[model samples]
Target chain A: MSSKHIVVIPGDGIGAEITAEALRVSQSAAKKCGFSFTHESKQAGGAAIDAYGVPLPEDTIEACRKADGVLLGAVGGPKWDNVAPELRAEKAILGLRKSLGLYANLRPIKVFPALAAQSPLKPEIVSEVDILIVRELNGGIYYGARQEAVIVNEVEQAWDREGYSRPEIERILRLACRSAIGRKGKVTSVDKANVLATSRLWRKVANEVAADFTQVEINHMYVDNCAMQLVLNPGSFDVLVTGNLFGDILSDEAAVLSGSIGLLPSASLGDGTGLYEPIHGSAPDIAGLGLANPLGTILSAAMMFRYSLGSEQVAAMIEAAVDQVLADGYRTPDIYQQGLTKVSTEEMGQQVINRLK
Target chain B: MSSKHIVVIPGDGIGAEITAEALRVSQSAAKKCGFSFTHESKQAGGAAIDAYGVPLPEDTIEACRKADGVLLGAVGGPKWDNVAPELRAEKAILGLRKSLGLYANLRPIKVFPALAAQSPLKPEIVSEVDILIVRELNGGIYYGARQEAVIVNEVEQAWDREGYSRPEIERILRLACRSAIGRKGKVTSVDKANVLATSRLWRKVANEVAADFTQVEINHMYVDNCAMQLVLNPGSFDVLVTGNLFGDILSDEAAVLSGSIGLLPSASLGDGTGLYEPIHGSAPDIAGLGLANPLGTILSAAMMFRYSLGSEQVAAMIEAAVDQVLADGYRTPDIYQQGLTKVSTEEMGQQVINRLK
Candidate 1:
């Protein structure tokens, strides 16, 4: 038996409602697998602003530091739109990522068989697709040298640099290789290597990293062609590793393939404690209505088990429970279909817990 | 009647055959509309390399500068893949765009009612979609400062700068507004404002440019969200404008929306002279055969009439005739369905010319 300590930050809006169900499901899974789980809830984003007048509180970071892993629901809303730039809810995410050194973000995209009918693509094109995009989260153009709104000779110009050190490329590529160790053992490094110097460097370092894992097959694709292939034939890709700029766009493009963005989970990992979260944002419009989908947060907890707690069997059990529930036609308001059993956020959580093997 | 002198560079492979059909259609349209048409053929790409050992010759640039506009068929093939990088087919495009000052790249994506079934997207989502992407061609990371493969401390690094001058942003936004003026008068400026300094500056300058054209409805979208929306709801957009790097990705993503990529045409415009070309590459395997699709080049000719020759009526006539031919079930090898009447490249061109109003 194993014991795990986790920090849960349900930041604003529907985050709390959906997060509650994830926690409940996690507890049930822990009991079924003979593992011990402990968690403490914390406030950030708008909730922190309302109470402590700051987007990220020191205590929240402190708790995360002391924990083995962190699970965040969602953050930001219309209420924090006009807040001072420094106190904005979105900053909480940037702050946490920076503070925790979360350099690699893992976004796994899969198309459930039962849910294939809901996809925008023809069923045959998207019926079987599983791709994990490993993005270098905390570096690249986003953190590079930048000049915004500078006037020279009364003319305004803007510039941003895209740079990647050897270590940054190595770390993310290594994480992707580790992910490949669990999957089909194929990695496609996407970049515009022929053009951008950063992408060229990215490709070189990726190849160097690939040399370390001889069992894993690695190839390269340009960012633009990767975008096209995602729609043309999504199943061909296994693991896609890229720098921040290209990953930000490609990951989002891959997310929409399933038409189940509300039910997808993501994990951000570093050399330290990792963070897991749903890919969807905080839907403040439906905060207290119980209409939010809990499956994403629930799946995030599953990812937490596999990546953070090192329990692959437990994670598979949780995911199979979800697949079973979805196959059985029980859905929340977000993924509701005609004749399917409709459940509230809490009810969906309970259903998954009940189905846990 | 105004006389338009243009240069036609039928680069390599199937380019010569496709260019012949487009020119024949252009001449028929000119005769029907009482406008004078004249063109000079020039060597470029593989053709120029075979003839003069250079991809883009100085004489060709001089001829293009003397013409009112330029029309180029597809360029590049595996035949030139091993040639010196500087003597490659791609340089011909770059050289022409730079020499002609073609800064605005216009890519129009439309889902033909007849071909909606061919889209990867379900018919309801992709049908009736018409979007125009106005991309600034001459600026941003593609033209930025670049450092490739610098080794330090026994590690390799690379960097690229994304810089946007005020005038570059203003010119592209102004062109987008002008495009909007001819369409629905709505423009969605895409950028990564939250992360990249260039995007933030792009947004700021775009807003300043928007104020001048008060009647045009302009909005902003991040590059990632724009990628999602391209698949989720392509019909909701009209005109999308952005910098070179973002445009390169987004435009290609948008290109695949219609699933009839072989039939799409693109235009690059500037103050001096505009260039029109088929978005498809030269297919050497199908070169000199009667099987290649010529509609993209024909439509490119139509764009030349409107954007370069200042003959919107001729352009509309050409487009409607192509629509008529397609609706009548005439198909080329690229777009042929089981029951449609199959036609060769020249026959399809003739059918459209016969249907011209």
Candidate 2:
């Protein structure tokens, strides 16, 4: 079998520290499982903005495009807050996405049975909750034609264009349905169709896509109701598909339901290679403290294995290894309980690797 | 004193039945307080759409405008799902808001001690939760200038103008801050200023307005993080103020944490009279079954007294009556526990009135 090449972009602050351990863990897992892996490191985000005069260097984007899979640590820090919007750390991620045409953002929120009590929701209600949010990333108000006038002459009017093409909506729905078919055979398309015309098109195209997936059950819910249901009856959802803005809000809430963003991983993909990353941002405050949680980054590697490399067995083994480590009481400071010992990022990585062995 | 005139718009489905009981309860309270209430009935929503060509009849709007306050008994039903968007039942509620210029939509979510165990959140987490959400309604994407393609085969691009004038943002923030000072003495302004230019203007104006109210501590949170924090640690919040769309989602989620939307009430106010209503939609499915919860509507009447008519004492009396009735172990089907006695909508309303006497 050909060796899989992975591009690692540990963008800023804690990102740099965490990505090292994530790579170490991945390397150890591949060795234990008898698979060949090759990894290379690149710089992006705030650090890139400082060094190369651009947050997303052309070479970095080219490297990501050519790699079989990409693993990214978190990005952005207050140190770079003064940077212009396009040149900021977050813009690098957005630039990579647009340049690579990465439209589908997949986020899985699951309540691990062992840690269910940590949920804000009652244990009985949240124990079995597992939801996959498929967000369309390339379109919506985020990338709309936005104009803002800050001058103190007349009243300032800021307008954001929210438009979606039939093809964009159709492709996203099709991708979501296929993902649903692979899991629980159910999908809930969320939109504000009751108000917005873009949502009307979204609902229409989603219905047409649903007709193609005869075996999968498709449902529609207004975005507001879906947000409520996510809180009150989280177990009822399987796969939720929505646009960029709603997805941003819903996914963040869903991430916290698991009790820690450190345990959540995400993937961004479209027609080409997938980019995997943890959902948490870089913590410049605790960068050198060695206290950053590395599990999210590790799990992102697991997603990269499955989605980019198409190695289901390898991915499952990586997941099982992490689960076993957690089940054995390895706790990072963020998720550390009353009696468990708090472990550093490198130690956590070592513990997971030991479990894999 | 002139008898306060309340225009009642019991729009459709269970609206009429529930509003009748809520009115009876309010009248009983008014009699005991040595005040009088005069109720004027009007047609609106889907029923109005069927009887008259318009969802909000001009006569109904005029009647509500002339009254001291308007009491809406929920709107929308599946019977009007196929109707044109403008003629839909929700249009009536929206029309009322725009016609009345009801810019501030205030929804208070509290997990009453009596209903603590009914919450989906852990009892320990939500036992003392009380939060107020002030949503800007008259402006933003909901009522913004929306341009849609009139015909197909054109480069169909739609744009929604989300404009909030300096004055509009300041007035709402000032009102919200004052309410916060009256209760928790803290205010959190939620926005997406990190992305949306309109939100930056909101942030700037809200900060400026907050300076005038030094007694109230003011802070800001991004909308997505705010949504997550609401679920993770709801008790940490006091009064949250946000734009129209974000407020709609967060308030709905907050409603869910109270366990049943059946017991929550809301108020929409601006330049003219305030509009009081329950947080629930007209449930056509359970209509005429006597299962609809009337507490929300009754509580809405209390909000009408406090916000519109400035009758704080009357509002407190209504709230006290509700507390006493719930303390007596009476439960609606939605909040029914194994051992509690289940009461119908009218029966529950009567119990509240009797307890007040």
Candidate 3:
């Protein structure tokens, strides 16, 4: 049997409780698939700040770099809200991404059939929304050089640069095309080509990268139109790929379509070790209350199995069990409907375990 | 009587038909309000390309500059799709904005109660969505300096600059605060302050500018969160102000929530002349047919009356008649429901004219 080593960072707030359940599920899924994995706990975010005087301790980074993959719970809370800008709790995740060289952030917005009624969109529209947004993480304006407010021509001004290289665009687009091949074989490369020079270059490179994957059909859409389409006709998209800034905006917009944001999972990937986490923030208000949902974290672990552990079967098994658990009418308090069986975080994980075959 | 001089540009495709109806509605509304305005027709867009070898002729620019306000129908069609980049029909609008120094673009996303059912969102969510987006049109990445693809460090790269000065931020924020005074007296300034330097400057300047308006309440939101909030709770926003790029995306996203893009109107304003138009595009396919909707163009004219033509009463009168027309179950082809009385482009304009009191 092939064995994998993983680092689990239960960062802050409800992180400890939710991540414990995710670990149990991962173990059970791995056992059922006749594979094995070893994971060790590491502290980051507010927890690390309290333990090591830094949001991202060198010890944690070393462990993550050597591990096959990392599973993180949400980070940051009011407790660390006033920390120095460099020592901010949220910096842990950013630091980990930079150290690990994670370049792409993948957000899969899937509305389960049982939870379709919870969507803000009309039922028919929400029912068919299964989009995977591939966001280039390491480049673009978010990480580009910037100027602080300074006097120029007797007026205070500030600026930021948005740039992309052919290599950067090619890699992300290639990943998007590869991702589409496993799904509906459609990729929508979104940019502001009509207005921005960077977007024009991105579009050109996207076309070239997509050509390598003949099975995948690729199209380009302006960011503005894509924003509207995500709400109006979300079912039409399979994979959406864009630069960091556009991705940051569109992914959040797409996540809310399902209405229950607590149930969405995300994965950040690069050439080496990948990072998996729920797209939601640390719900400190509900920390340790047994009311927080564990599905997103559990799903993140599933993504870890498929993308990093090289266990597609275990991934599919875990996902199928999650689908069955929801179909069996088990819900966490956050997603609880009046007539359904409302389960605690531990109970929801166990419910998925019970449904696993 | 205070007589105002206005110029009307009936550009390509459905532009001529819609503008004629809007012009007639303007005349009737002005007559009823006891205000007088003199108007002249000007050519632009593809029409001007054919007549004067340019999308925006010098004659049209001079006429628009001399007028108190300008009303334009939609521009661009397939006929001008292959033109040189600079001579494209769309360039007419850009040129006009530059020549006239229009720095603010106002897009009011008001969902008529009768048409709430048309929204993709649950009726309860979208029904209360009446947001006015005040976009800074002259600056940000769209107008910033850029680099086309070039070999940097032996890799082809492209970049665009996003810069904002204190004066630009102050002017737009002041406009937003003033605009909010007439409505809900609340302004949500959107930016990406946590990540970008420009956004930080914008936030700093926004607070300083908003202090001048005691009647207005202002709050700040990160652009990513704002994008999600637009879908999750659009009704919570009164007047949303932001830089150019973010505004371009959000305004288009907000427009589709009403489900009838054809019924949306827009206005671009500056220190001197202002331009008004519908937010929808010219439907070249349905050009000569009576299927086009004229409410958007008529509403644009009404906006002109309020903002530039100096007649708020006429604006209100036109708006009330529009609401009454919709309430009376009249619908154009694009927004027609099964049980509503379907009216032609011309008849719809007539309906609003008849209801004006």
Clashes of each: 0, 0, 0
B133-163, model 1: which lDDT tens digit per residue?
9999998999999898798788777889999
TM-score of chain A for each candidate?
0.98, 0.94, 0.99
Per-candidate interface DockQ score? 0.81, 0.62, 0.92
Predicted structure 1, TM vs. truth: 0.98
lDDT of 3 by residue, B1-357 (tens): 989999999998899989999999999989998999999999999999999999999999999999999999989999999999999999999999999999999999999999899999889999889899999999999989999989978999999999999999999998899899889999999999999999999999999999999999999999999999999999999999999999999999999999899989999999999999999988999998998999999999999998998899999999899999999999989999898999998999999999999
**lDDT per residue, candidate 1, A1-357, as tens digits?**
677899999999999998999999988887888888789998889999999999999999998877888999999999999988999999998889988889999998999998998888889989879999999998899889988778888877888899998899998999998899969999999999889888888888899999999779999999988888898889999999998989999999999999889889999998888899999999999998999999999999999999888888778889999999999998888888999999999889999998999
Whose DockQ is greatest here? 3
Ranking by lDDT: 3, 1, 2
CAPRI rating of model 3: high
Best by TM-score: 3
lDDT of 3 by residue, A250-281 (tens): 99999999878888999999999999999888
Question: What's model 3's interface RMSD, roughly to a tenth of an angstrom?
Answer: 0.5
Over 4 Å off, model 2: A32-34, A46-54, A78-87, A150-154, A339-342, B46-55, B78-87, B149-157
Residue B171, model 2: lDDT of: 83
Task: Give the runs in model 3 whose Cα sits over 4 Å from its true position.
Answer: none
